[model samples]
Target: MGVFTKFGVRLLLALVLLCSCSIGYESDIDYSLMPVKQGDKWGYINAKGEYIINPQFDGANVFTDNGLARVWVGDKCGFINKKCEYVIAPQYSSATDFFEGKAWTVKPKGAPVLIDTKGRSCFTLKNVRTVYNYSGGLAVVVDDNEMFRAINTAGETVFELSGPAFVTNFVDGLAAVQNMDRLFGYVDKNGKAVINSQFYGADFFLNGKAIVRADDMYGVVNKEGKYVINPQFAEMQQDYNKFLIKIGEQYGWCDERGKIIINPQFENAFPFFGANLAAIKMGEQWGYVNKEGKITVNPQFQFALPFIGKVAWVKSADKWGLIDEDGKFVVNPQFNDVLCSYRLFIPVRNYVVSEYFDVEGIISWINMMLDGNKVDGMTVTQTTISGFRKKYNLGEKGVSVEKKYSRDMSYEIYANGTFYENVSDGWWGTTTKQLPNARLDYVTIQLKLKDNENTRPLYDAVINALGGNNGKRGSGQYVKVKASPGIVTIYVSDKQIKDILNDNLGWSNY
Candidate 1:
């Protein structure tokens, strides 16, 4: 079995976090400077939505512990200080956020180098295919030989594992390692196994206990290699003071001693974050439950996120906004999408621009379709036709269905007759049998202009928003075509241009 299968779900979550450039020492994060997006540019904004750092960079990340933020200038990545000055120039192919006053950077066709906060190269690591950030004075690297090793900040190998083993960064003086047999155990700073590799999985130790798996079930284990709570639950995730457990596909809460605090009843649940309340899904709606399993917030939101500080991001209908602890809307639901980081800033995307031919409007629509994964509250390959109709309050007469060659299907929803949505499905013919519940493969909005109206301005706007015909902004390709006289159609889909051509939609390269 692969390492992912052996590590199970919790380790997969940790791996995903580790893979991101924003991964850092959480306690050292400075939330005062948060990254926000304005139009097509990124900048730092305060809690009050005031622009602290003007929108200039192509991309921006959260401020690390050392008062530096990673930003992208064109295709290069660098670090900038709070004063909007370049602390580290845009030179690296990619870079991770600073942790413990040091960061890892990769040069173009060069070895990965560890750099100090002042942009001085400490050392270059060779023969390593993968590198992790330094934690607890040690970092983990996977060598070209596919073996894990621990290295010091000086780039000297502290110790190499005895055999092929998967290792994690040092946490609390120990690191979780998996032996060749795919059994996990804890190893000390000197690479000595303190806990025997017997369990199917292991997590980083916290508060003297680590979650482990045995008999294909999860439980808690102490640092001394003894089970504190025997493996019994199907899954276990340690939150602040409670453990989110799964039993037979349902989620519940349990205390530290494995005492059930809440029955496994909800369809899904989120861990408590920055507050005592956690979001739980009941049927199709989401609500919050306190530590005692009391429903503090009723199930009303279309979607909900974990609480951060005094507020949480929630979805009401198709728009997202902020809500207080009592489930009251502190910020009205008006944004197409909202992103929060470090509980300090909110990046709002307003895709409903008034003029479709303007630069800002075109950019907003492009970002919404490509980056935001949305097209008028419907996500391709996720939102079913029935759900879309229900969400938009579209009746039978509002939507017109068309079967293409008895293999592909399309749903057209008209809005005031000037514009209409073309929802496509069954391109591969597999989804044709799943009508009504079949998810949309792609969506296109067609606009009918006035008699003899020029389409050049709208076409140019789309090209500019997409960073020219080369399509540099995102991976998705867009095609602008004049289907008929006085009718202009712009198709935006995650599918490639070649794949769209295969659909025989009569679209030509611009």
Candidate 2:
């Protein structure tokens, strides 16, 4: 027999035996299985409140679409089938609900890995600074270098992207991305810029339509970047085939082609569910609205959730109850909480950001250093300054130079300071002390630019101030300033010899 079939038989037999010996019984939310608390422990009970499984677990989650639920034993978590058999052992520190026959989990002090139904490890990803669950056969991850990438089931990189400044995730075949200009656009699986970056914000496409923002207004746009709905509504919502639009503070319903099916009248609204019915609020109470904007279920309850299989959970005067499509109470208001557990098997989307890094802070620090003047840490001498001046053609009259500090990938800056032979005089004749000779003080500074070409202007300005590097005289005493790929060294000490450096970047004293 299949695993679920065998477990079902065992569960039925246990329920029958328990019901025969129990004193009283009550039905659960869906009348399938109920949760009971006994002596501080929780377990599953039948529709009649009879024990299906004894209260042995510390906590338990609702069963998922894969017919398995997560249960906690003391401090550890494990998955159990309908018959209460361990499918995946409780070894991971934390885990998400299973998706596409696999689940993402984290080991103690280890990287995140994917595990199959048999608890077999697929592969462990490295440098995964942050990761999300799997969805559409891929997951989004940010590496240690702060680069965003998408990985498939085998942990292979499918594509590397620049950003998702506002909202982005693959839904159909396109994923939203934010360009360098902070505008939103769509990209295909191959990382090609499919749509031009123009919208202020956007969402994943559903039914060949996506919600987009333009001029601080929300509207629906097609895959071809054409707006089916005009950019006018303050809010928009999609439910199956209907569109919910809100103008000002009042809510209304419209079709996909920007046609208003219902006038803006209700105070609030929600997406439509079973039988084309939507839950809406009239004043302070909630009710159901149909596609024609007709009120079918009267507004009576304080709050009402969407229907499932013709039944829904409702609230009245701080009490909870269950109601049918005709608004008749199936379960009277009594309990403090009510749950529609029968239809709780919703799939979790994998394209989400769990942990985000502070990109702005790092950029700010780099900008600060570009504007700083005071230099600290390692120092240079006078003789070394002369060598730099001669090497880079600082002209006949030497000038004071400044070197900024910066770090590499490892966050460490390796500086080759100037050194010279030192001679010392003592009472016992004369001796030489091993020490640097020149007083050339060069401060290393790191400037992070979005593009390397941006340094060209600064380089030209510095070289001009130093009277040109090719033995050509320009102006200023301190000459021979040069800049290369990822580096800049200037030989100027006048401090007032015309601060030629641009104010584009902020510098700090190291």
Clashing pairs in 1: none
lDDT of all the models against the reference? 0.63, 0.56
> What TM-score number comes out for model 2?
0.59
Error of 2 at 1 (Å): 41
> Candidate 1's residue-wise lDDT over 1-510, tens digit each?
122232122210100011111112245556565565556778765544456898888878777557888889998889999999999999877777776798888866456788899999998765566677787788878754567788888888999987576445666677888878878898999989999999888777666777888977899988898888889988876575667788888899888888898999998787674366788899999999987789999999988876656666677988756677799886666544443442121111111101112224344654564565445555545666666567667664333332211111112332211123344554843322325655555555564434222345544555556565432234444443334434345454444333334243332343
Deviation (Å) of 57 in candidate 1: 3.3
Clashing residue pair totals per candidate (backbone < 3 A): 0, 34
Ten-residue stretch with the least lDDT total in model 1: 346-355
Q: TM-score of predicted model 1?
A: 0.61
Give the deviation of candidate 2 from the true structure as CA RMSD: 16.5
Model number with the top lDDT: 1
